[model samples]
Target: MSNPFSYPTTPHVRKHGPAGYREWENYRPWLRDEFDFRCVYCLCREKWGRRRSSWVVEHLVPREKAQHLALEYSNLVYACSSCNSAKSAKWVPDPCQHAYGQLVYVTNDGKIHAKNADGRKFIRTLALDEDDLTNYREMWLHILQSWKKHEPERYRQCMSFPDNLPDLTQKIPPNNTKPEGANNCCYQQRKQNKLPEIYG
Candidate 1:
C-alpha cells in the first residue's frame, strides 16, 4: 500500500483555472479537485473527517499581504482548517513551484523531517512537527496500516476519492482562462469511468 501522507515528488501542476469569482469561497469546489481532495500542505484527505467543514480555501500569498492577488486562481490552494490557521499570513515555499516531497519526509513514527532551509521553513511555518500534529499523523498511520491489513474494504474507503467530487463542467466562473480544463475535471473523468478507485 502507498503512504497516503507522501507528498508529490514533483511540483504540482494546476489542472483547473476557474477565475473572476466575486468571493474566494466560490472557488472551494474547484480548489478541492485541484488539490485532489487533500490539504496541499499536510496531505490531509477529505476522507479523514467531516467533508465540508474540515476543509478551507487558503491563499498562497495571503489576503492581507496581497489584496490584489486575493482572487487570483493561481494563488489559491486547498487546506485543512488546522494547516490554514497555522499558516495564517505566513509565506512558505510555493507547492506549485516547489515539490514538497523533496523538501520533507515523514517517518513511520509520524515525525516530519526537513531536507534543507526551505524545507525547515515550510515545516516551521506550518508547525508541521508540533506534537499534536505529529501524534495525529502517527495515529492515522497505524490506523490505516491496521485497516489495510484486517479491513480491506475500510482501507479502500479511506484511500479512495470522496463521493462528492464537484462537476466543474457544470460550474461557470465569471471568467475562466482554461475553459477547456472543465472537460478534464475529476467529475468528467469519473463519468467516463476513467477515475481510479484508490489513489496512492
Candidate 2:
C-alpha cells in the first residue's frame, strides 16, 4: 500500500520478570481486536481456513533492532506460527549497499508486497509461497473478490462488522454438513480457536 504508522510502543507494562507474560497478555487482545485475528501477511481469516495460520504475534521488524518496540501495537501483527518463526528477528533481508526507500512497515497502509531482497527472502525463508500458504491466501483473496463481485450489499455488511472474518469464523454452524474436505487443516484450526462459536 502506502506509508503507514509504526507500531505503538508500550513502556509502562513491559518492565521485566514474570510481568513479561503480562505484557503479552496486555497486547494480544488489543492487537487481535485491531487486526481482527487475521494473519496480516496473508490475511488468513477465521472464516477462511487456518491451515496457514501462525496464530501468533509478528513484529514488523526483527525483535532485536526494535526490542523496545516489542509491545508497540503498530509493529505487531497476528500471524501464522510459521510466519513468526520464519520472520525470526530478521524483518528485512540483505540490502544492496545503496538500496533506497524505507523498509516495509505493517501499518494501516501496509500492503503484502515484498519489494526488496530482505522482504523477498523473508517470504522464501518462511515458505510463504508454499502450496499450503498459497492456498489459504488465494482462498481469502477469493472471498474478498467474491464480496466485491456478486454480493456487493452483503460485502458492505461484512465490512461493517469490522472484524468480519474473525467474527464469522468464530460462529459455529449448527449442522454437521461441512464441505467434505472442509474438515481439513484450516477448519480444524478454526475449531481449535473456538471459531465455530464465533461464526457459522
Q: Best candidate, TM-score-wise?
A: 1
In terms of lDDT, the poorest run of 10 residues in model 2 is: 10-19
Q: Identify the candidate with maximal lDDT.
A: 1
| Candidate 1 CA-lDDT value | 0.89
Deviation of model 2 at 73, angstroms = 5.7
Model 1 / residue 31 / CA error / Å = 0.4
Model 1 Cα lDDT, one tens digit per residue, 1-200: 68887989999988888889989999999999989999999887998884225888899999999999999999999999888988999997788999999999998898999988889999999989999878878988899899999999999999999999999999999999888888998899899999998997
| Candidate 2 lDDT, 67-135, residue by residue in tens | 876755445556667666766766532222212123222322223345566656655666566666555
Candidate 2, residue 30: Cα displacement in angstroms equals 1.9
RMSD (Cα, Å) of model 2: 13.7
